[model samples]
Target: MGPAQKPNVCRQLSRRALGFFSRDAGVVQRTNLGILRALVCQESTKFKNVWTTHSKSPIAYERGRIYFDNYRCCVSSVASEPRKLYEMPKCSKSEKIEDALLWECPVGEILPNPSDYKSSLIALTAHNWLFRISATTGKVLEKIYLASYCKFRYLSWDTPQEVIAVKSAQNKGSVLARQAGIQQPVLLYLAVFHVLPFSLIGILEINKKIFGNVTDATLSHGILIVMYSSGLVRLYSFQAITEQFMQQKLDLGCACRWGGTAGTVGEAPFGIPCNIKITDTPPLLFEVSSLENAFQIGGHPWHYIITPNKKKQKGVFHICALKDNSLNENLPTVTASGRVVKRTFNLLDDDPEQETFKIVDYEDELGLLSVVAVTQIDAEGKAHLDFHCNEYGTLLKSIPLVESWDVTYSHEVYFDRDLVLHIEQKPSRVFSCYVYQMVCDPGEEETTNRSCEKETNLNIILNSDNHSSDC
Candidate 1:
């Protein structure tokens, strides 16, 4: 018989969970495979219009195209057969759909120097920040100017002809006023921005039943002005919007507004260098003045914290356990494990945080591991971990990963089943990026603990792949 193929339980799990998060908050995966497949795989890897917003009736422009409200551009002209939402589409003139550069498109974050010429600029919806996309490509053309205060939350837009889009993070949505150039969109609101980029950004609203709670709250639309980037309020948020638009002609660095009106810049108002300071968080801004020496900082923790640099490039990311956090420190080393233990992980060539390397050839072969590391978006957001593992993994000791974590929580629970625990994952990216297991129950501890059994052990690893050989 031919060599056995590895089963793909992991991918199966990711897909199902993803569908549940994006569409029905109530829709949950029956197993771990469902959540793994859905979140990790590129939305393109699956069907298109899997969710209502992607579909026509559920979410489409007057032009009969998938209106990317964030950038205010038609994603593509040659629409897909609504049925084939998961199938890939050929490039055409009408819409420009790109999955490869979705997460970390380099140009979007590339900061243009003083010499480089920038054509037009606009603020995003929630005043989260602003950006400059390629006038022609809508690819973040350049990032020359930015405000350096208050984090912009989200943004929504309302065009002249009844079109709407919200701009938040890559995972969050942005409203793109594709109609008028940087002149300022009419009837645009600050709140109500509920769409992500035209990429694989998926959201799982656990607060309410996915798309539930439709109250007068939830910030769908608003108008406000900023005295500065701080919480200091001005008159009408709309006044701030109007003033910022007019200033675009005079002030080279004030096209974006903060506080509430996300005019265009995604982070423009938050990082602007003009000495016009806004709301400053906590103590004075902290900066790592030195980087030659460092000290260790973790002891058998469950998850490690990775501080993202303001500027990012392309590359592969191995699991890391930051050993130190002193004023002077060397780069932290990652203890690569989990799905990354066997395969290669690549970062997006453009922007590292927004887009990641989507695996096309390895999905069916690697299973759940693929779902975890098809390369992932490290965008600003929140998520949590949930798991129940078997015994073989539970027995291992002094695991490299367990000691590598920068932070871990200790929560022991009693169970009726005689099951030893081993598996774990970070519930949220904003909380902890990954989860590690360590220190199995001792014989004495087992006798006292309800979850573990001292009499017998269990191993949960699966057998050979069935699809490849059964075929």
Candidate 2:
């Protein structure tokens, strides 16, 4: 067979060979062929919108249900179609008394119960109230007040009994603090709590004088990474923090100071200069940082900092691989292998005015051995979902996500198998859930039509030349 016909002939041979093999062997051969076909046709991938739903609050998807907070917090089943499963009771006016505790605030974050992920969920509200609610019945099983008037920015659950950590900031010039004549800067609080029984563990009060304002924080594999506005990044040992928490159990009311003795493993400057012009209202001080439990590269950890340049309309991802040097020291010292910068779009020939880009969300799935999946939005309000190779940050694949731009709304996205769950939060206390199905687009029909037309034209040209020769 010729080079162009070899593929077809080989496919025919494979099908015939499959009939000769046993049923189990045929199944294996078919699976291998499917993988081969996918490798050969990687660029044909496309995404289709499957379903969309509207809500009054931010939505969280777990398994087959979508959880959100509204007048009454509720969970909706989205197995086949979106339908309300259950709604929690609304807080009565009498129950809204000053002394009364209520879990009626808009939920800022929703996390699955680590022990019972399927049936229960833990929700943190905008008012710093944490509640463990039943996923099926929407019943408030337990709730705890973290801190009053504390603006929480980050929430994460960590190992060693799955302790939850919440990062919040309280302005010193607030009503209570100002009345007390406290002239210090904004106090950053990292509250640790247990969800099983819903009890406060201990709060880590970050020293602004030493660490500066915390821009971002994440916990992974017993390691706590805290990034500051001063361009400083610090790593802490969660085990050491737990030990200190145990020691200060009697004085849990008083916040424990961070650093010095509280699990200061290693510290480093982010190294990248903060020169980007942020376009957010009030202007953010620093770029967002993400820490991944990257054990693929020599079993070491990796973290990334995405800096958005509004003027240039680009996102510069600073990737650093952390090496464990704990054997020499008592605690693990995180040393970066090197920093790699990956730009979202090509700067050499790309026009900034045409498309302004911002990274809304990105995830690093270390377990799946897949590289980072980034969700980027353009100025025209289109979501560009792409995956990049882990080592050099090369483009792997782009899955088109359909979206419209609304300045009054914000977005969050989650990827699971072949489904993409996009949640958009609006200004008037509403959110929208959009689910997309990822599939391969076969362009064989167009290719076949074009090939047939070309062959017919060529045959006619040859026949006319032969007629002229005969004449």
Candidate 3:
């Protein structure tokens, strides 16, 4: 069948309208309305607010501890009180840092130590500085300068000892270079760092002018998948990239050198060619039509790419499965199979320009994926947590989050099994916790028995009251 004629496997109701029904009621009604008896008997599940906290700075939760921007707080479920574990030292003003404190730093990403998350954490600032802080004492253990004129946006742990960082595609320097007749290739910098000793392993630069601007990149199952604005998706062997960077680091005798040079020759002289090799094996490439946003659920073999249908105000999801044997080799050349299926869902609130959607969590057993839909109305920030069945794109539930008008700050949501934790910043920080639990409705027989018992109790109460009045 042609693409246009294919039926929509999943259709969702309007968010505002769906809020009226019970959570599971909406799912059952939409999926199988013909089974009226089953729908009436099935119990509904909903999220209940468990606890909330207010923090002076941004917060992240892992295990049982709540990690603030500069310190770690130990919080227990039974008690909402937070005991401060450590506090990091303030940044020196002599350094001319944009934000003196780590929590308030601009364009920063913080991650826990993969080897020992409870002992240490890592923070990457927009100024290209990486800081490793002790979680127990809040002391800066190690710090390294990555690169100048480079702005990093994302960080992922490749291994317990290694971390990978990617540069922002909307970097001002690259944008200006493209417009100023200096076609410097707009290099996409990917830096690898060693966590324990705290050293830069090496840098991998991709020529964006040759390919296209990077829209999204992720590391999964030892493969690096990068999606470009030109509808190109390429999978590279992350192990191969790391091996090349290690070799270059050994040859140059410095962490930041390129092609046996003393400094980063690639960035020092703009457009200057460097002999640093990226990878010996060619990357597996897939050209997707109208590809805009793409991401993979960790530990899953499926890669999802979204294409916006502006005319209909919908987003189409193209689910593709990865080959089983592709990532087994030393120099992995991963390839995606043919498109498995296409699922369509409405754009956030049916407005193409006002809202954005991002996949936040995926439940493997239930085959459900959670998406955070953020919409800005009249400069006020509003968001909803949407759960959708991955196979059919059926929206199971939509829960509205607390509203915040602070557009400058972004909100964070973390899903932990049946519990969800969210952090938001308006002027200060607020942490909220929700638990998904079953709300059982009495069965027909149980309901009848309860009604009889209540009637008998009412008669006894009436008789007692009448006797007391007469006396």
Candidate 4:
């Protein structure tokens, strides 16, 4: 492979590859068909032929449907078996799809089922419109316009009385008069909508002062958890909104019990005010005086508040169980106020230079938390990665990866099944993905321990990130 012969060699390889696939022979046909079924061939303008290229877009899997975006501005779905279903048109000629989510109502835990509602729906939010499409047919079932007042930052699906969750992004802004002490206005508004009719139920304007800036909000098991930038979390009752949607007919005479306007037959319905004030003062979950603003909330049922202590450079993970709602199973319960300190722990204390570590991203699957962290950098301009496994502080496996300074990583975790998929790419436009089946059974410990040695060989395979050019 001399420099001068490289181009000629690649040209020959490409022709042979095409000729091999173009064959109509028995073996060739079977091989080609099997490959096609194993992976999708996506066409994009950036690359002339993306048949063999792996997409960098996020892959979403729900109820057997696999959703991903083709760089050409189309969001498409297929079965997990890699069969194409539908490719939605760009949100508009000018706008690309911002986000797409698949949600099933009657997610029987958070809210009761609506009388008229039946199955799940695909939510595609683009520009200023939210389109509810049928999951099976990929046809637009309904379209709802998000008003100018409520900026849609994220969309979360609640478990109806059947359950799943999805995410979307939406925004809010106001004109500010410049002055010495003037600050740009920031507000958190909760917009409720009827999923079946695809109409706005109401928009609840939350007081900004209540909790500095809303960092994240999620609705689960009928309780709405709001996290703030200051590490303050507040729980609000979603019953008010759930109760109204359950009714077969609208109650216009029912004034908002939360001090908002009412909902009409048409327009934003605020008829049943959210009883956000379930208590005179809602229970405050956390008040980290020394906490910086880089925290994230994860975990189901029990909320895992993860943040790094900049001073120590170690990550702090706080686990708070949702308030015991066993007695009041009607709505999601909030964790009592005094349990934050007792439940908190340091993520990885054994690492010598844990302070230099950064928690890039993590996923909880197969009863273990897979945390991808960039270990302390070495002097050779190369970096290492440690897949820190934490079953709530009990470390399971810490697999170290090959040293590489500037590699990009994308991953997908399947909740329905116990499988982890990771794609790593280097600056040379080379990509490699690995599917690791998480085996944590005590009976399989002997076999699993032997597999750890093979991980070193896998890391060596990753070193050859450079690939031969197809053209």
Q: Which pairs in model 2 have colliding backbones?
A: none
Please give the CA lDDT of all the candidate structures: 0.25, 0.47, 0.47, 0.40
TM-score of each: 0.21, 0.50, 0.50, 0.47
Ranking by TM-score: 2, 3, 4, 1
Cα lDDT for residue 339, candidate 2: 30
| Candidate 1 per-residue C-alpha lDDT over 319-345 given as tens digits, one digit per residue, 9 for 90 to 100 | 234344332334333322221123446
Question: In terms of TM-score, how similar is model 2 to the real structure?
Answer: 0.50
Q: Encode model 3's per-residue lDDT on 309-399: one tens digit a residue.
A: 2335234443444443233223223324222444344444655337677447775534457888877786576777887645556565776
Please write out the lDDT profile of model 2 over residues 221-321, one tens digit for every residue: 55656675544556666556556433344222333333233321111111111111112222122233223311211233543333332324233333333
- How close is each model in CA RMSD to the real structure? 23.4, 18.2, 17.1, 16.6
Residue-level lDDT tens digits of model 4 in 72-144 = 1222221111234445554443344455555555434454434324344445344444555666556666555
Worst 10 residues of 2 by lDDT: 265-274
The candidate, 1 or 2, that scores higher on lDDT is 2
Quality of model 3 by C-alpha lDDT = 0.47
2 or 4, greater by TM-score: 2
**Native-structure RMSD, model 4:** 16.6
